[model samples]
Target: MKSKGKVYLVGAGPGDPGLITVKGRECIETADVVIYDYLASPALLKYAAPTAELIYVGKKGGDHTLPQDGINALIVEKAGGGRIVTRLKGGDPFIFGRGGEEAEVLAAAGIPFEIVPGVTSAIAAPAYAGIPLTHRDFTSTLAFITGHEDPTKADTGIHWASLAKGIGTLVFFMGVKNLPHITRNLMDNGMAPDTPVGLVRWGTTTRQESVFGTLENIVERVRAAGLKAPSIIVVGKVVTLRDTLKWFENRPLLGKRIVVTRAREQASDLVKRLTDMGADCLECPTIRVAPPEDWRPLDAAIENLAAYDWIVFTSVNGVKFFFRRLFETGHDVRALHRLQTACIGPVTAETLMGFGLKTDILPENYRAESVVDAFRGQSVAGRRILLPRAKEARPVLPVELTRMGATVDEVTTYQTVQVRDNAEMLVGELADGAIDMITFTSSSTVQNFKALLPEGEPLERLLNGVTVASIGPITSDTARELGFTVDVTAESYTIPGLCDAILAHYQRL
Candidate 1:
């Protein structure tokens, strides 16, 4: 006699992964089992607990993974077993999502359930494309209708007459396939042929594209543009406003597919910045950061922090891993009060500042030569300096410091290993000339990316027409040594600098 668990039919919102409501995200985090749809952004899955079981019940038009009855039965079975289930739908569940049918099934089975509404594509897609559904100047009334209907029904369920004449604005979801039928039906019902229309594909994302035409030629235009399903179709005089109001399509980096070569854990900021600028960023993390095989040297350095006059950090990972080891050994930030801290760049300095520590030295440029120059006027006749950094980092900093009469004890805090999760996919994309650019943030990312490629694959052939963007000169030199034509270099050697260079290159084109 086990008690039943509750089910929540939650809406995942429109295409933008960020559009999901906070409550919807919380439901996913707490759910014991999550069943998501094809339209739901895969990025939302990161919110679910790692222990939760995720099942895909995606049902695209004419391609049902699980029939409606089967989906209903699956939910009943999971809830009966006392597992909380989150049924993630694309848009507002009650609107054309068949949420009512599933809820009725759960009700008949005596399962406790709740419905969570989402921002439907009907309104969101058009809005992201810069079209207002209702306007004081255009039309005041709006209607939402399905572009496809059931074949089993003997008659069409939609009222074509009222929609044509009465509705001032019309939005059809999943309507690309039935464009001809939809246009003919509207015109037959006395809708004017000259009425404007707009089709938005993959709206609200970096890959979003919009196509515009009048009702008389919209179908042909959609075909010419090769717009696919999961598109939003807007009809009526409101579509005319898209030309004056289109903002997303006019972005500088729109439609450009760029690859990010930072480590997976560190790629978020770079990815977000590029996506915000309308680049379709592919997160291809080249290396993964991890603890060194042995912690003895790092522990020894921490135990003797009082003997050192300077502690230098070369990367954000160095600061992160060094502090992690410090806290793990029962020491806090106070242990470093006797030592002055120096960082190579602003990003590393910011990470150190996050731990309530101030930097004594921050070089203007992000390089070992710059750090060496920054310490030229200081007296280091007999100062002991401790550097905790990547295992395979360059030795120029320590070598130069020792010449300046300083005793430098460099210890390895972390190591980076190459990752090959999608090497084959990357190769395919490159071979097909689908990739437009590849960005390198560090020398390690550049090295590991070359290592991940198939041995002896000609770099020139792979990057024939692709632009190579580097964060700084050090990274750019490494890319050049590998025979890559460096097209853009960030003057500031920062994430935002790299993004600006990429945009500037495109703007010039």
Candidate 2:
């Protein structure tokens, strides 16, 4: 007999990636193979190691991508081979995720297994929409039921009438198709016709949408609103609280589409923060940074470093790349014994400090204007200032320093080129209306977006209805120049501020 492996049936939590439990993340990280369902958020896959094999065993109503028997066999086969297997499911695996059936199969095969619980949509859906399952003033109990069942069975075995009268709150999953039947049953079973009910679709995600109406008219209202499946149906007075406690949708940048022009490597944090506030982020890299085309200029700059009075780093990228070159040439920050270092922002200053170099000057505000202002009124006659930055970088620093009577030697430490093909796949997404918004963090992103967009009136028509979000005045000007209206701009020049601006716009509507 082969040595059996351990299997973990892990819950991925309701739609929100942050809601995923720590233990579930641990299991996914260590698992050799992860079999996941379609409903699970793709973000959760990031927790798995790159070497781990991922298998999709998602099933829809009557359509099975991988049959239950096949999935069961796969799990058992992998476990029997002594590989650590993780069965990742959306929400609580045990709660209608068919985790019990898989557990039984694992047990019958004598495979060791453990279950990691998650925040089930049964509770999280309502929570994200501010609908509590139970309220002390309204009700003390809650019931979770499925809206889908086998029609061939003798009966669902649920006492609808008893539940309608006895339960304070009733939450149903997969109930969109049977909304009419469920509403009628509840009404006939002594539930009030005017009882509040809400259908939350794509809960806890930026795409989340909520429809509210009484039991008497919810079916009609949802139909009129074109609400789709993968929704949670809540029947209770708690549904009324959404109007007052709607904090998620109140973020500054909620529902606005902003385009981030930063490189892929640097855009994750900014994009995540913007998306969390309900803003749809579009990533269009206006500038692609690459190593300098020739090392002569960089080598010469390093060798004559002591002749310069000041070394100004315009970006964190320049700081990083320059230091890497310095190390390659077998010289450290100590070699710059007489050069004063000036950084544009706290982030740049911190990066310089990481290399054991203290910044001599850092501005309170993080902009080119601020950096130039910090050195204003200081005598710069005959002083040599070294500026190592991107090839296409703005000439504000060099021009302004020259005006200040300083001899500036500008070196292209890196090249920032336009990305032409990044939007190839996104064209289909844009045409299909899957892209709800496009956010612009900088003027360059707006320019690059227009360059990448497909030609003609189709691009304009596509962007017409899509909300345009800007990070600041400069980005807004670029967006307006592209013939698109700016929908929202952050009060502060930070990603979180941009998000808050988006949310504020949506909440006002």
> Which candidate number maximizes TM-score?
1
In model 2, which runs have C-alpha deviations exceeding 4 angstroms?
1-5, 61-63, 80-82, 151-153, 257-259, 282-290, 293-304, 324-333, 353-358, 362-376, 399-407, 417-422, 434-436, 442-448, 455-459, 467-509
Let me know the TM-score candidate 1 reaches against the reference structure: 0.96
Q: How much lDDT does each candidate structure score? A: 0.91, 0.83
TM-scores for every predicted model: 0.96, 0.85
Q: Across residues 69-181, which tens digit of lDDT does each residue of candidate 1 receive?
A: 98999999999999999999998899999999999999999999999999998998888898999999989999999987653477998899999999999999888998898
Error of 2 at 247 (Å): 2.8
Q: How many residue pairs clash in each candidate?
A: 0, 21
**Per-residue lDDT of model 2, residues 46-118, tens digit only:** 8899999999988766678999889999999998999999999999999998899999999998999999998
